[model samples]
Target: MTTQSAGEPGEQGGPLGMQIDHVPSEPGGSGTPGPPGPWQPNLVSTPAQKKAAAQAIEDHIEPDTSKAGDHADDETGKAVTAFAPKDGDGWVTSTSLKSAHKTWGDQVKNLMNRLASEKAALRSTGLLFQTTDFGIGTGLRQTSPLDGY
Candidate 1:
């Protein structure tokens, strides 16, 4: 006959042949409690809910073309003016203001590129949410706007 302790290895099907030393008590236990388990929400999203969520993400991914174009044009003008030769008769004209203007123009260009990259990343994420299977069995199918792209 084989005998095992109540909390011993494989006694109650504990993980990895290890015993559970302590069970979690209610709040306000003297000993420090273990980390919480993974969260499992009881609620499931309906088709309408899924559609609304996908639409919201899609809307958020849309870039403001007009504003982006205006900013790009303004920044290009500033860069051209900053690097242009001065009216004075000097071989090289390097002023603090010109340097600052050049720096500002470069910063503007960096900001625009960063914003575009971030938008592209967000759009890709949104598309993933639309196409990837959630495995929730809600019978909801999301279609990405960039499906053909």
Candidate 2:
């Protein structure tokens, strides 16, 4: 089933359905100010939230996605190997398939490595921000008190 936000006038929602709106007159230039009001931030992530996201990726998403890719890679290898010519006569198709399989396996490995890197970055984010905050607070505390004029 397709899903869309209300009042979007036939706009759909999903990765492929993403739409860009309100292009500025000049590229990358501030054109017009938005309607003045109390603006809420679109993104707000706490240290705990970052940590939890990292945990979820490591514990669930990474494993599930990698498992599917790995299974596909293995199955493809087995199938291609089975179809390969024994006498090495008509080996064109088999060779092509083997090459494609290797390419796909490399892609999957790269994706898994990227996910692992992302997970590591997420795990360290909380500590990095905490240290930054502490340093800022300490610097502020070191300031001399103002005297009455």
Candidate 3:
């Protein structure tokens, strides 16, 4: 009683249905050959490109702090600041309002820092698309809950 492998002809219920003529042991195979060399994309950023991207991000965030200050000056903004309690000598002291003000200020600072860090990291390593080019190609169609109308 002898057994035949699937690669052999006349083996009906074997792993491989058809017989494999030959198998190459080389890395690629005995064919046209692999790529001439390693392939690279043309979109990779250079040092200058990375620097420019970082600079652009910095420039964009530069006005954000001032904007935050302006927003804090509004009535609602002042209300947040005024939430802080004043001491007997009229010096603003630790209180819920002071904490709220600190929290808001920290949030704005964190946002700026995060944006700058993300920009730097992304610039160092090129991204599929720049931050600004995200929504360029899109249809103008708008949908809402009242779609039937």
- Model 2: clashing residue pairs? none
lDDT scores of the candidates, listed in order? 0.55, 0.76, 0.61
Model 2 shows how many backbone clashes? 0
Over 1-149, each residue of candidate 1 has an lDDT whose tens digit, in order, gives 34465555563576343345664364545355555434433466555665565455445433454355557667756665665667753323334445655676677667667656655564466456666646443456557698879
lDDT of 2 by residue, 2-116 (tens): 5556555662342333456666654444566664334534577877887888899889988998898888878887877777888755567678888888888788888889888
- Winning candidate number (lDDT): 2
TM-score between model 1 and native? 0.30
Worst 10 residues of 3 by lDDT: 32-41
Q: Model 3: runs farther than 4 Å from truth? A: 1-53, 69-94, 126-149
**Each candidate's TM vs. the true structure?**
0.30, 0.61, 0.34
Q: For residues 9-69, could you state the per-residue lDDT of candidate 3 as single tens digits?
A: 5545445443356554444555445544334236666767777777777786657665865
Q: Give the C-alpha lDDT of model 2.
A: 0.76
> Which segments of model 2 are wrong by more than 4 Å?
1-41, 137-149
